[model samples]
Target: MNRKKSIAHKLLDAIGLFEIHKLIAKHINQHHADIVVDYDLSLLRSAHLIGAPKIGFFHFRPKRFRNGGTNKLRRIGERLKHYQKLVVLCDEMYEEACFVWPHLKDKLLVLPNPVDLDSLLKKSACSIDFPENLTPGEYFVSVARLTHQKNIHLLLRSFAKARELGCKWSLAIIGDGEDRVDLLDLSKKLGLEEAVYFLGYQTNPHPYLAKAGGFVMSSREEGFPVSLLEGMALGCPIISLACPTGPTDILQNGKLGKLISFTEDNPDELGLAMFEISNNAALRKNYAEESKLFSQNFSSQKIAHQLMSLLRDIASNQRP
Candidate 1:
Protein backbone atom coordinates (compact mmCIF):
# COMPACT_ATOMS: atom_id res chain seq x y z
CA MET A 1 0.00 0.00 0.00
CA ASN A 2 0.80 3.68 -0.17
CA ARG A 3 1.48 3.74 3.55
CA LYS A 4 4.26 1.18 3.14
CA LYS A 5 5.86 3.29 0.43
CA SER A 6 5.55 6.36 2.62
CA ILE A 7 7.33 4.58 5.44
CA ALA A 8 10.09 3.45 3.11
CA HIS A 9 10.55 6.95 1.78
CA LYS A 10 10.66 8.38 5.28
CA LEU A 11 13.47 5.99 6.10
CA LEU A 12 15.43 7.04 3.05
CA ASP A 13 14.81 10.73 3.68
CA ALA A 14 15.92 10.32 7.26
CA ILE A 15 19.22 9.06 5.88
CA GLY A 16 19.67 11.42 2.92
CA LEU A 17 21.92 14.47 3.10
CA PHE A 18 21.31 17.72 1.29
CA GLU A 19 24.40 19.15 -0.41
CA ILE A 20 24.27 22.48 1.49
CA HIS A 21 24.47 20.81 4.91
CA LYS A 22 27.44 18.74 3.77
CA LEU A 23 29.30 21.81 2.52
CA ILE A 24 28.61 23.79 5.71
CA ALA A 25 29.65 20.95 8.01
CA LYS A 26 32.77 20.28 5.95
CA HIS A 27 33.69 23.97 6.13
CA ILE A 28 33.01 24.28 9.87
CA ASN A 29 35.08 21.17 10.63
CA GLN A 30 38.08 22.88 9.07
CA HIS A 31 37.87 25.68 11.70
CA HIS A 32 36.71 24.01 14.91
CA ALA A 33 39.16 21.72 16.75
CA ASP A 34 36.22 19.29 16.92
CA ILE A 35 32.64 19.46 15.64
CA VAL A 36 29.48 18.67 17.61
CA VAL A 37 26.08 18.48 15.99
CA ASP A 38 22.88 20.30 16.94
CA TYR A 39 19.96 17.92 16.62
CA ASP A 40 16.59 18.38 14.87
CA LEU A 41 18.57 20.98 12.97
CA SER A 42 18.24 18.77 9.89
CA LEU A 43 17.20 15.34 8.70
CA LEU A 44 20.67 14.98 7.24
CA ARG A 45 23.59 13.82 9.40
CA SER A 46 26.21 14.99 6.92
CA ALA A 47 28.25 16.78 9.54
CA HIS A 48 31.94 16.05 10.19
CA LEU A 49 32.62 12.63 11.68
CA ILE A 50 36.39 12.62 11.33
CA GLY A 51 38.16 13.10 14.66
CA ALA A 52 35.08 15.07 15.75
CA PRO A 53 34.29 15.52 19.43
CA LYS A 54 31.55 13.32 20.77
CA ILE A 55 28.65 14.61 18.67
CA GLY A 56 25.95 16.48 20.60
CA PHE A 57 22.39 17.30 19.48
CA PHE A 58 19.72 19.91 20.18
CA HIS A 59 16.44 18.02 19.95
CA PHE A 60 12.87 19.28 19.42
CA ARG A 61 10.17 17.65 21.46
CA PRO A 62 6.42 16.82 21.17
CA LYS A 63 7.20 13.49 19.57
CA ARG A 64 7.62 14.05 15.88
CA PHE A 65 7.70 10.28 15.75
CA ARG A 66 7.55 7.23 17.95
CA ASN A 67 10.82 6.36 19.73
CA GLY A 68 11.45 2.89 18.30
CA GLY A 69 10.25 3.10 14.69
CA THR A 70 11.76 6.51 14.09
CA ASN A 71 15.08 5.93 12.40
CA LYS A 72 15.97 9.60 12.86
CA LEU A 73 15.58 9.31 16.63
CA ARG A 74 17.53 6.08 16.65
CA ARG A 75 20.36 7.56 14.69
CA ILE A 76 20.40 10.67 16.90
CA GLY A 77 20.42 8.64 20.10
CA GLU A 78 23.23 6.46 18.82
CA ARG A 79 25.27 9.58 18.13
CA LEU A 80 24.40 11.12 21.51
CA LYS A 81 25.50 8.07 23.47
CA HIS A 82 28.85 8.03 21.72
CA TYR A 83 29.41 11.81 21.65
CA GLN A 84 31.11 13.77 24.41
CA LYS A 85 28.32 16.32 24.89
CA LEU A 86 24.63 16.19 23.89
CA VAL A 87 22.50 19.30 24.21
CA VAL A 88 18.77 19.46 23.41
CA LEU A 89 16.67 22.57 22.69
CA CYS A 90 13.49 21.55 24.44
CA ASP A 91 11.10 24.19 23.14
CA GLU A 92 8.33 21.65 22.93
CA MET A 93 6.36 24.11 25.04
CA TYR A 94 3.61 21.59 25.63
CA GLU A 95 4.49 20.38 29.09
CA GLU A 96 2.32 17.30 28.70
CA ALA A 97 4.76 15.95 26.13
CA CYS A 98 7.84 16.97 28.12
CA PHE A 99 8.29 14.00 30.43
CA VAL A 100 7.10 11.39 27.94
CA TRP A 101 10.68 10.60 27.05
CA PRO A 102 12.17 10.19 30.52
CA HIS A 103 15.67 9.44 29.26
CA LEU A 104 15.77 12.65 27.22
CA LYS A 105 14.53 14.88 30.06
CA ASP A 106 18.01 15.46 31.49
CA LYS A 107 19.44 16.43 28.09
CA LEU A 108 16.68 18.86 27.07
CA LEU A 109 17.76 22.52 27.23
CA VAL A 110 14.23 23.99 26.95
CA LEU A 111 15.45 26.55 24.41
CA PRO A 112 13.32 28.15 21.74
CA ASN A 113 13.94 27.31 18.11
CA PRO A 114 16.30 29.65 16.26
CA VAL A 115 15.58 31.31 12.94
CA ASP A 116 18.03 32.47 10.27
CA LEU A 117 16.91 36.06 10.93
CA ASP A 118 19.63 37.51 8.72
CA SER A 119 18.29 35.66 5.72
CA LEU A 120 14.75 36.73 6.53
CA LEU A 121 15.91 40.35 6.96
CA LYS A 122 17.73 40.30 3.64
CA LYS A 123 14.77 38.62 1.94
CA SER A 124 12.36 41.11 3.48
CA ALA A 125 13.50 43.64 0.88
CA CYS A 126 12.14 41.46 -1.91
CA SER A 127 8.48 41.80 -2.99
CA ILE A 128 6.05 40.21 -5.40
CA ASP A 129 3.72 42.10 -7.69
CA PHE A 130 0.06 41.58 -6.93
CA PRO A 131 -1.92 39.49 -9.37
CA GLU A 132 -3.96 41.37 -11.96
CA ASN A 133 -7.34 42.38 -10.41
CA LEU A 134 -5.83 41.96 -6.94
CA THR A 135 -5.30 45.20 -5.10
CA PRO A 136 -2.74 45.82 -2.38
CA GLY A 137 -4.18 45.73 1.16
CA GLU A 138 -7.05 43.60 -0.15
CA TYR A 139 -5.49 40.24 0.65
CA PHE A 140 -4.79 38.08 3.69
CA VAL A 141 -2.00 35.53 3.62
CA SER A 142 -1.24 32.24 5.30
CA VAL A 143 2.12 30.63 4.57
CA ALA A 144 2.22 27.07 5.74
CA ARG A 145 2.46 23.61 4.31
CA LEU A 146 -1.10 22.47 3.50
CA THR A 147 -1.53 19.93 6.25
CA HIS A 148 -3.76 18.94 9.15
CA GLN A 149 -1.43 20.31 11.79
CA LYS A 150 -1.43 23.71 10.10
CA ASN A 151 -5.27 23.82 9.89
CA ILE A 152 -5.11 25.30 6.38
CA HIS A 153 -8.70 24.16 5.74
CA LEU A 154 -9.93 26.31 8.62
CA LEU A 155 -8.24 29.32 7.06
CA LEU A 156 -9.77 28.56 3.68
CA ARG A 157 -13.27 28.29 5.17
CA SER A 158 -12.78 31.50 7.12
CA PHE A 159 -11.62 33.38 4.06
CA ALA A 160 -14.56 32.04 2.03
CA LYS A 161 -16.95 33.21 4.74
CA ALA A 162 -15.26 36.58 4.77
CA ARG A 163 -15.86 36.81 1.03
CA GLU A 164 -19.50 35.84 1.51
CA LEU A 165 -19.85 38.54 4.12
CA GLY A 166 -18.73 41.08 1.47
CA CYS A 167 -15.31 41.53 3.10
CA LYS A 168 -13.92 41.15 -0.48
CA TRP A 169 -10.38 40.27 0.54
CA SER A 170 -8.36 37.57 -1.23
CA LEU A 171 -6.55 34.83 0.68
CA ALA A 172 -3.20 33.65 -0.61
CA ILE A 173 -1.74 30.35 0.58
CA ILE A 174 1.94 29.68 0.05
CA GLY A 175 3.56 26.25 0.50
CA ASP A 176 2.59 22.73 -0.58
CA GLY A 177 1.91 19.38 1.07
CA GLU A 178 -0.38 16.31 1.06
CA ASP A 179 -3.46 18.38 1.89
CA ARG A 180 -3.24 20.37 -1.36
CA VAL A 181 -5.85 18.39 -3.29
CA ASP A 182 -8.34 18.39 -0.45
CA LEU A 183 -7.86 22.12 0.09
CA LEU A 184 -8.32 22.83 -3.61
CA ASP A 185 -11.51 20.81 -3.60
CA LEU A 186 -12.74 22.67 -0.53
CA SER A 187 -12.00 25.97 -2.23
CA LYS A 188 -14.08 24.92 -5.25
CA LYS A 189 -16.89 23.73 -2.99
CA LEU A 190 -16.93 27.04 -1.13
CA GLY A 191 -16.85 28.93 -4.44
CA LEU A 192 -13.50 30.35 -3.42
CA GLU A 193 -11.47 29.14 -6.37
CA GLU A 194 -11.20 32.71 -7.56
CA ALA A 195 -10.68 34.24 -4.15
CA VAL A 196 -8.16 31.67 -2.84
CA TYR A 197 -4.86 31.38 -4.65
CA PHE A 198 -2.66 28.40 -3.91
CA LEU A 199 0.99 29.23 -4.41
CA GLY A 200 2.87 25.99 -4.48
CA TYR A 201 6.10 25.38 -2.65
CA GLN A 202 8.38 28.40 -2.52
CA THR A 203 11.99 27.75 -1.57
CA ASN A 204 12.52 31.44 -0.87
CA PRO A 205 9.24 32.68 0.55
CA HIS A 206 10.32 36.29 1.13
CA PRO A 207 8.77 37.72 -2.02
CA TYR A 208 5.41 36.26 -1.09
CA LEU A 209 5.86 37.53 2.43
CA ALA A 210 6.68 41.01 1.21
CA LYS A 211 3.61 41.43 -0.97
CA ALA A 212 1.21 40.08 1.63
CA GLY A 213 -0.91 42.73 3.37
CA GLY A 214 -1.08 40.68 6.55
CA PHE A 215 0.03 37.31 7.91
CA VAL A 216 -2.18 34.62 9.47
CA MET A 217 -1.47 31.29 11.14
CA SER A 218 -4.24 28.82 12.10
CA SER A 219 -2.19 25.95 13.34
CA ARG A 220 -3.78 23.48 15.77
CA GLU A 221 -0.38 23.07 17.40
CA GLU A 222 3.24 24.09 16.89
CA GLY A 223 6.68 24.19 18.50
CA PHE A 224 8.04 27.63 17.68
CA PRO A 225 7.10 28.13 14.05
CA VAL A 226 9.61 30.02 11.90
CA SER A 227 6.88 31.33 9.57
CA LEU A 228 5.62 33.61 12.36
CA LEU A 229 9.14 34.89 12.90
CA GLU A 230 9.68 35.34 9.17
CA GLY A 231 6.37 37.23 8.98
CA MET A 232 7.41 39.46 11.87
CA ALA A 233 10.78 40.14 10.27
CA LEU A 234 9.15 41.03 6.97
CA GLY A 235 6.87 43.51 8.75
CA CYS A 236 3.65 41.79 7.74
CA PRO A 237 0.92 42.35 10.33
CA ILE A 238 -0.12 39.06 11.91
CA ILE A 239 -3.22 37.23 13.21
CA SER A 240 -2.47 33.85 14.67
CA LEU A 241 -4.65 31.25 16.37
CA ALA A 242 -3.94 31.33 20.08
CA CYS A 243 -2.17 27.94 20.17
CA PRO A 244 0.15 26.33 22.62
CA THR A 245 3.89 26.91 22.89
CA GLY A 246 4.55 29.20 19.92
CA PRO A 247 2.14 31.80 18.51
CA THR A 248 0.93 33.29 21.81
CA ASP A 249 4.50 33.62 23.03
CA ILE A 250 5.60 35.23 19.75
CA LEU A 251 2.59 37.54 19.87
CA GLN A 252 3.38 38.19 23.55
CA ASN A 253 -0.16 37.01 24.42
CA GLY A 254 -1.90 39.07 21.69
CA LYS A 255 0.16 42.25 22.11
CA LEU A 256 2.05 41.85 18.83
CA GLY A 257 -0.95 40.44 16.92
CA LYS A 258 -4.49 39.23 17.42
CA LEU A 259 -4.76 35.88 19.20
CA ILE A 260 -8.09 34.08 19.20
CA SER A 261 -9.34 30.87 20.66
CA PHE A 262 -8.71 27.73 18.58
CA THR A 263 -12.23 26.58 19.49
CA GLU A 264 -13.92 29.42 17.58
CA ASP A 265 -14.40 27.63 14.27
CA ASN A 266 -16.81 30.20 12.81
CA PRO A 267 -15.52 31.96 9.73
CA ASP A 268 -16.79 35.24 11.17
CA GLU A 269 -14.14 35.13 13.91
CA LEU A 270 -11.46 34.65 11.32
CA GLY A 271 -13.17 37.10 8.99
CA LEU A 272 -13.28 39.79 11.65
CA ALA A 273 -9.55 39.39 12.11
CA MET A 274 -9.03 39.58 8.37
CA PHE A 275 -11.16 42.74 8.28
CA GLU A 276 -9.27 44.36 11.13
CA ILE A 277 -5.84 43.87 9.55
CA SER A 278 -7.05 44.60 6.02
CA ASN A 279 -9.03 47.72 6.96
CA ASN A 280 -6.80 49.16 9.67
CA ALA A 281 -3.60 50.47 8.11
CA ALA A 282 -2.39 51.99 11.36
CA LEU A 283 -2.59 48.72 13.27
CA ARG A 284 -0.72 46.93 10.45
CA LYS A 285 2.02 49.57 10.50
CA ASN A 286 2.33 49.39 14.27
CA TYR A 287 2.45 45.60 14.20
CA ALA A 288 5.07 45.65 11.49
CA GLU A 289 7.32 47.97 13.50
CA GLU A 290 6.91 46.04 16.74
CA SER A 291 7.41 42.69 15.01
CA LYS A 292 10.68 43.77 13.39
CA LEU A 293 12.07 44.69 16.81
CA PHE A 294 10.79 41.45 18.38
CA SER A 295 12.33 39.25 15.68
CA GLN A 296 15.93 40.46 16.30
CA ASN A 297 16.58 37.95 19.05
CA PHE A 298 16.07 35.04 16.67
CA SER A 299 18.33 36.43 13.94
CA SER A 300 20.99 34.18 12.46
CA GLN A 301 23.81 36.19 14.03
CA LYS A 302 22.29 35.79 17.48
CA ILE A 303 21.62 32.08 16.99
CA ALA A 304 25.01 31.52 15.43
CA HIS A 305 26.64 33.32 18.34
CA GLN A 306 24.70 31.15 20.76
CA LEU A 307 25.73 28.03 18.88
CA MET A 308 29.37 29.15 18.87
CA SER A 309 29.24 29.91 22.56
CA LEU A 310 27.94 26.43 23.23
CA LEU A 311 30.71 25.10 21.02
CA ARG A 312 33.32 27.00 23.00
CA ASP A 313 31.95 25.67 26.23
CA ILE A 314 31.98 22.13 24.89
CA ALA A 315 35.35 22.56 23.22
CA SER A 316 36.89 23.88 26.44
CA ASN A 317 35.68 20.93 28.47
CA GLN A 318 36.04 18.24 25.81
CA ARG A 319 38.65 15.62 26.74
CA PRO A 320 41.14 14.43 24.21
Candidate 2:
Protein backbone atom coordinates (compact mmCIF):
# COMPACT_ATOMS: atom_id res chain seq x y z
CA MET A 1 0.00 0.00 0.00
CA ASN A 2 1.03 3.65 -0.43
CA ARG A 3 0.91 4.19 3.34
CA LYS A 4 3.39 1.36 3.90
CA LYS A 5 5.80 2.83 1.31
CA SER A 6 5.56 6.25 3.00
CA ILE A 7 6.42 4.72 6.35
CA ALA A 8 9.38 2.87 4.81
CA HIS A 9 10.68 6.12 3.28
CA LYS A 10 10.42 7.91 6.63
CA LEU A 11 12.32 5.06 8.33
CA LEU A 12 15.14 5.37 5.79
CA ASP A 13 15.32 9.12 6.36
CA ALA A 14 15.53 8.61 10.14
CA ILE A 15 18.38 6.10 9.72
CA GLY A 16 20.27 8.43 7.35
CA LEU A 17 19.89 11.35 9.74
CA PHE A 18 21.16 9.27 12.66
CA GLU A 19 24.24 8.28 10.69
CA ILE A 20 24.89 11.92 9.78
CA HIS A 21 24.59 12.94 13.43
CA LYS A 22 27.06 10.23 14.46
CA LEU A 23 29.56 11.40 11.83
CA ILE A 24 29.21 14.99 13.02
CA ALA A 25 29.78 13.89 16.60
CA LYS A 26 32.87 11.96 15.57
CA HIS A 27 34.26 15.01 13.75
CA ILE A 28 33.64 17.21 16.80
CA ASN A 29 35.38 14.76 19.08
CA GLN A 30 38.37 14.46 16.78
CA HIS A 31 38.76 18.21 16.46
CA HIS A 32 38.42 18.76 20.23
CA ALA A 33 35.96 21.56 19.58
CA ASP A 34 35.20 23.97 22.43
CA ILE A 35 31.58 24.47 21.42
CA VAL A 36 29.24 23.47 18.62
CA VAL A 37 26.79 25.94 17.12
CA ASP A 38 24.05 24.51 14.90
CA TYR A 39 21.46 26.34 12.80
CA ASP A 40 19.06 23.44 12.14
CA LEU A 41 16.83 21.61 14.64
CA SER A 42 17.81 18.21 13.22
CA LEU A 43 21.49 18.81 14.01
CA LEU A 44 20.80 19.19 17.75
CA ARG A 45 20.64 15.39 18.09
CA SER A 46 24.40 15.25 17.42
CA ALA A 47 25.04 17.15 20.65
CA HIS A 48 24.22 14.05 22.72
CA LEU A 49 27.40 12.27 21.60
CA ILE A 50 29.65 15.35 21.29
CA GLY A 51 31.63 16.29 24.40
CA ALA A 52 31.59 20.03 23.74
CA PRO A 53 28.76 22.33 24.76
CA LYS A 54 26.22 22.91 22.00
CA ILE A 55 24.16 25.94 21.01
CA GLY A 56 21.11 25.90 18.75
CA PHE A 57 20.52 28.99 16.60
CA PHE A 58 16.95 29.01 15.29
CA HIS A 59 16.22 31.46 12.46
CA PHE A 60 12.50 31.03 11.69
CA ARG A 61 9.32 30.95 13.68
CA PRO A 62 8.25 27.38 14.37
CA LYS A 63 4.56 26.65 13.77
CA ARG A 64 4.24 24.71 17.02
CA PHE A 65 5.63 27.64 18.98
CA ARG A 66 3.41 30.11 17.16
CA ASN A 67 0.08 28.29 17.44
CA GLY A 68 0.86 26.86 20.89
CA GLY A 69 -0.46 23.52 19.69
CA THR A 70 0.60 20.56 21.79
CA ASN A 71 1.21 18.39 18.71
CA LYS A 72 5.02 18.74 18.28
CA LEU A 73 5.86 20.81 21.36
CA ARG A 74 6.84 17.74 23.37
CA ARG A 75 9.20 16.55 20.63
CA ILE A 76 10.77 20.02 20.45
CA GLY A 77 11.08 20.09 24.23
CA GLU A 78 13.00 16.78 24.10
CA ARG A 79 15.44 18.27 21.57
CA LEU A 80 16.17 21.22 23.85
CA LYS A 81 17.80 18.93 26.41
CA HIS A 82 20.71 18.24 24.05
CA TYR A 83 21.90 21.85 23.87
CA GLN A 84 23.30 24.07 26.61
CA LYS A 85 21.95 27.23 24.93
CA LEU A 86 19.31 28.17 22.35
CA VAL A 87 19.55 31.53 20.53
CA VAL A 88 16.30 32.96 19.22
CA LEU A 89 16.02 36.02 16.95
CA CYS A 90 13.77 38.17 19.16
CA ASP A 91 12.51 38.65 22.70
CA GLU A 92 8.97 37.70 21.66
CA MET A 93 10.22 34.33 20.42
CA TYR A 94 12.12 33.85 23.67
CA GLU A 95 8.97 34.61 25.70
CA GLU A 96 6.88 32.25 23.56
CA ALA A 97 9.44 29.46 23.77
CA CYS A 98 9.70 29.78 27.54
CA PHE A 99 5.93 29.85 27.83
CA VAL A 100 5.61 26.69 25.73
CA TRP A 101 8.49 24.93 27.42
CA PRO A 102 8.83 26.52 30.82
CA HIS A 103 11.48 24.06 31.97
CA LEU A 104 13.86 25.26 29.23
CA LYS A 105 13.87 28.80 30.66
CA ASP A 106 17.55 28.91 31.57
CA LYS A 107 18.65 27.74 28.11
CA LEU A 108 16.93 30.45 26.07
CA LEU A 109 18.65 33.70 24.89
CA VAL A 110 17.49 36.64 22.75
CA LEU A 111 19.89 37.78 20.02
CA PRO A 112 18.41 39.99 17.31
CA ASN A 113 19.81 39.81 13.79
CA PRO A 114 22.74 42.17 13.16
CA VAL A 115 23.71 44.36 10.20
CA ASP A 116 27.05 45.91 9.09
CA LEU A 117 25.88 49.53 9.37
CA ASP A 118 29.26 50.97 8.26
CA SER A 119 29.49 48.88 5.10
CA LEU A 120 25.78 49.31 4.37
CA LEU A 121 26.13 53.14 4.56
CA LYS A 122 28.96 53.01 2.02
CA LYS A 123 26.91 50.90 -0.41
CA SER A 124 23.85 53.16 -0.05
CA ALA A 125 25.78 56.03 -1.66
CA CYS A 126 26.24 54.18 -4.95
CA SER A 127 24.28 55.49 -7.95
CA ILE A 128 21.84 53.40 -9.95
CA ASP A 129 19.65 53.85 -13.03
CA PHE A 130 16.93 55.47 -10.98
CA PRO A 131 13.33 55.10 -12.09
CA GLU A 132 11.99 58.09 -14.06
CA ASN A 133 8.79 58.58 -12.08
CA LEU A 134 10.17 57.63 -8.66
CA THR A 135 11.69 60.61 -6.83
CA PRO A 136 13.80 60.37 -3.66
CA GLY A 137 11.95 61.20 -0.40
CA GLU A 138 8.63 61.02 -2.25
CA TYR A 139 7.94 57.26 -2.48
CA PHE A 140 7.68 54.22 -0.23
CA VAL A 141 9.87 51.16 -0.84
CA SER A 142 9.75 47.50 0.18
CA VAL A 143 12.38 44.78 -0.35
CA ALA A 144 11.01 41.26 -0.13
CA ARG A 145 10.37 38.22 -2.28
CA LEU A 146 7.00 38.28 -4.09
CA THR A 147 5.34 35.56 -1.99
CA HIS A 148 2.26 34.83 0.09
CA GLN A 149 4.22 34.92 3.33
CA LYS A 150 5.38 38.45 2.54
CA ASN A 151 1.77 39.58 2.06
CA ILE A 152 2.73 41.83 -0.90
CA HIS A 153 -0.86 41.49 -2.05
CA LEU A 154 -1.87 43.24 1.14
CA LEU A 155 0.66 45.93 0.37
CA LEU A 156 -0.79 46.50 -3.11
CA ARG A 157 -4.32 46.60 -1.75
CA SER A 158 -3.25 49.10 0.89
CA PHE A 159 -1.50 51.21 -1.73
CA ALA A 160 -4.69 51.36 -3.79
CA LYS A 161 -6.63 52.37 -0.70
CA ALA A 162 -4.05 55.07 0.07
CA ARG A 163 -4.53 56.49 -3.44
CA GLU A 164 -8.28 56.59 -2.88
CA LEU A 165 -7.57 58.44 0.36
CA GLY A 166 -5.65 61.06 -1.72
CA CYS A 167 -2.05 60.01 -0.88
CA LYS A 168 0.22 60.98 -3.81
CA TRP A 169 3.34 58.95 -3.00
CA SER A 170 4.16 55.87 -5.12
CA LEU A 171 5.35 52.43 -3.96
CA ALA A 172 8.43 50.66 -5.34
CA ILE A 173 8.92 46.98 -4.52
CA ILE A 174 12.36 45.45 -5.12
CA GLY A 175 12.32 41.64 -5.16
CA ASP A 176 11.20 38.66 -7.29
CA GLY A 177 9.87 35.16 -6.62
CA GLU A 178 7.29 32.54 -7.73
CA ASP A 179 4.37 34.82 -6.81
CA ARG A 180 5.49 37.46 -9.34
CA VAL A 181 2.90 36.63 -12.03
CA ASP A 182 0.01 36.43 -9.59
CA LEU A 183 1.07 39.62 -7.79
CA LEU A 184 1.43 41.48 -11.08
CA ASP A 185 -2.07 40.38 -12.04
CA LEU A 186 -3.39 41.56 -8.68
CA SER A 187 -1.61 44.89 -9.09
CA LYS A 188 -3.36 45.46 -12.41
CA LYS A 189 -6.71 44.35 -10.98
CA LEU A 190 -6.30 46.86 -8.14
CA GLY A 191 -5.62 49.66 -10.68
CA LEU A 192 -2.19 50.32 -9.16
CA GLU A 193 -0.26 49.99 -12.43
CA GLU A 194 0.93 53.59 -12.37
CA ALA A 195 1.43 54.00 -8.62
CA VAL A 196 2.98 50.65 -7.76
CA TYR A 197 6.26 49.74 -9.50
CA PHE A 198 7.83 46.29 -9.33
CA LEU A 199 11.61 46.67 -9.71
CA GLY A 200 12.37 42.94 -9.36
CA TYR A 201 15.52 41.69 -7.62
CA GLN A 202 18.33 44.18 -7.28
CA THR A 203 21.91 43.10 -6.49
CA ASN A 204 22.24 46.20 -4.30
CA PRO A 205 19.03 47.40 -2.64
CA HIS A 206 20.79 49.77 -0.22
CA PRO A 207 20.81 52.69 -2.66
CA TYR A 208 17.08 52.31 -3.14
CA LEU A 209 16.63 52.09 0.62
CA ALA A 210 18.65 55.25 1.14
CA LYS A 211 16.61 57.17 -1.41
CA ALA A 212 13.23 55.93 -0.16
CA GLY A 213 10.91 58.25 1.73
CA GLY A 214 9.76 55.35 3.88
CA PHE A 215 10.27 51.57 4.19
CA VAL A 216 7.29 49.33 4.79
CA MET A 217 6.99 45.68 5.88
CA SER A 218 3.66 43.84 5.50
CA SER A 219 4.73 40.29 6.23
CA ARG A 220 2.38 37.95 8.08
CA GLU A 221 5.45 36.65 9.88
CA GLU A 222 9.21 37.29 10.11
CA GLY A 223 12.31 36.15 12.00
CA PHE A 224 14.06 39.43 12.80
CA PRO A 225 13.93 40.99 9.32
CA VAL A 226 17.31 42.27 8.16
CA SER A 227 15.67 44.41 5.47
CA LEU A 228 13.89 46.50 8.11
CA LEU A 229 17.18 47.00 9.91
CA GLU A 230 18.87 47.95 6.65
CA GLY A 231 16.11 50.48 6.07
CA MET A 232 16.76 51.97 9.48
CA ALA A 233 20.49 52.04 8.75
CA LEU A 234 19.69 54.04 5.60
CA GLY A 235 17.57 56.49 7.66
CA CYS A 236 14.23 55.57 6.05
CA PRO A 237 11.10 56.06 8.14
CA ILE A 238 9.40 52.69 8.76
CA ILE A 239 5.84 51.32 8.71
CA SER A 240 5.61 47.59 9.43
CA LEU A 241 2.87 45.20 10.48
CA ALA A 242 3.57 44.12 14.05
CA CYS A 243 4.27 40.56 12.93
CA PRO A 244 5.63 37.79 15.02
CA THR A 245 9.08 38.08 16.61
CA GLY A 246 10.83 40.97 14.88
CA PRO A 247 9.29 44.34 14.06
CA THR A 248 8.14 45.13 17.60
CA ASP A 249 11.64 44.55 19.01
CA ILE A 250 13.33 46.49 16.21
CA LEU A 251 10.89 49.39 16.31
CA GLN A 252 10.96 49.41 20.11
CA ASN A 253 7.18 49.08 20.32
CA GLY A 254 6.41 51.70 17.64
CA LYS A 255 8.60 54.45 19.12
CA LEU A 256 10.96 54.31 16.14
CA GLY A 257 8.26 54.05 13.44
CA LYS A 258 4.68 53.08 12.62
CA LEU A 259 3.83 49.52 13.73
CA ILE A 260 0.39 48.26 12.70
CA SER A 261 -1.39 45.22 14.04
CA PHE A 262 -1.66 42.32 11.57
CA THR A 263 -5.05 41.29 13.04
CA GLU A 264 -6.73 44.44 11.64
CA ASP A 265 -8.20 43.10 8.40
CA ASN A 266 -9.32 46.46 7.02
CA PRO A 267 -6.86 47.87 4.48
CA ASP A 268 -7.62 51.31 5.90
CA GLU A 269 -5.21 50.84 8.83
CA LEU A 270 -2.15 50.42 6.61
CA GLY A 271 -3.62 52.78 4.00
CA LEU A 272 -4.08 55.56 6.54
CA ALA A 273 -0.56 55.01 7.85
CA MET A 274 0.90 55.32 4.35
CA PHE A 275 -1.17 58.46 3.71
CA GLU A 276 -0.09 60.12 6.95
CA ILE A 277 3.62 59.42 6.47
CA SER A 278 3.48 60.65 2.87
CA ASN A 279 1.81 63.92 3.84
CA ASN A 280 3.78 64.79 6.99
CA ALA A 281 7.36 65.86 6.40
CA ALA A 282 8.08 66.69 10.06
CA LEU A 283 6.92 63.25 11.23
CA ARG A 284 9.02 61.56 8.56
CA LYS A 285 12.12 63.50 9.54
CA ASN A 286 11.67 62.68 13.24
CA TYR A 287 11.05 58.97 12.52
CA ALA A 288 14.11 58.91 10.22
CA GLU A 289 16.35 60.40 12.86
CA GLU A 290 15.09 58.02 15.55
CA SER A 291 15.44 55.07 13.17
CA LYS A 292 19.09 55.88 12.40
CA LEU A 293 19.99 56.46 16.05
CA PHE A 294 18.24 53.29 17.27
CA SER A 295 19.83 51.20 14.50
CA GLN A 296 23.35 51.62 15.90
CA ASN A 297 22.48 49.23 18.73
CA PHE A 298 22.18 46.40 16.20
CA SER A 299 25.50 46.98 14.44
CA SER A 300 27.60 43.91 13.63
CA GLN A 301 30.44 44.83 15.98
CA LYS A 302 28.20 45.11 19.06
CA ILE A 303 26.31 41.90 18.23
CA ALA A 304 29.57 40.05 17.52
CA HIS A 305 30.93 41.08 20.89
CA GLN A 306 27.79 39.91 22.69
CA LEU A 307 27.87 36.54 20.87
CA MET A 308 31.59 36.05 21.60
CA SER A 309 31.05 36.85 25.26
CA LEU A 310 28.25 34.27 25.46
CA LEU A 311 30.38 31.64 23.69
CA ARG A 312 33.38 32.35 25.88
CA ASP A 313 31.36 32.05 29.05
CA ILE A 314 29.74 28.83 27.90
CA ALA A 315 33.05 27.32 26.77
CA SER A 316 34.69 28.21 30.07
CA ASN A 317 31.99 26.26 31.94
CA GLN A 318 30.38 29.45 33.29
CA ARG A 319 26.67 30.04 32.88
CA PRO A 320 25.83 33.12 30.79
CA deviation > 4 Å runs, candidate 2:
1-5, 62-69, 318-320
lDDT of each: 0.70, 0.86
Measured with C-alpha atoms, the lDDT of residue 291 in candidate 1 is 89
Over 1-320, each residue of candidate 2 has an lDDT whose tens digit, in order, gives 33367888778888988999899889879987778778666576677798778888878774445344585777778877889999998888888778777888899998877899889999999889999999889999999998888988888888888889899999999999999998899999998898888999999999999999999899988887989989988889999999886899899999999999874356779988999999999999999898889889899999999999989888888334
In angstroms, the error of model 2 at 130 is: 1.0
Candidate no. 1 TM-score = 0.73
TM-score per model over all chains = 0.73, 0.94
Q: List the residue pairs that clash in candidate 2.
A: none
Can you tell me which runs of candidate 1 are displaced by over 4 Å? 1-35, 41-60, 66-97, 102-104, 110-113, 127-129, 164-166, 263-268
TM-score of 2: 0.94
Clashing pairs in 1: 39-58, 54-83, 54-84
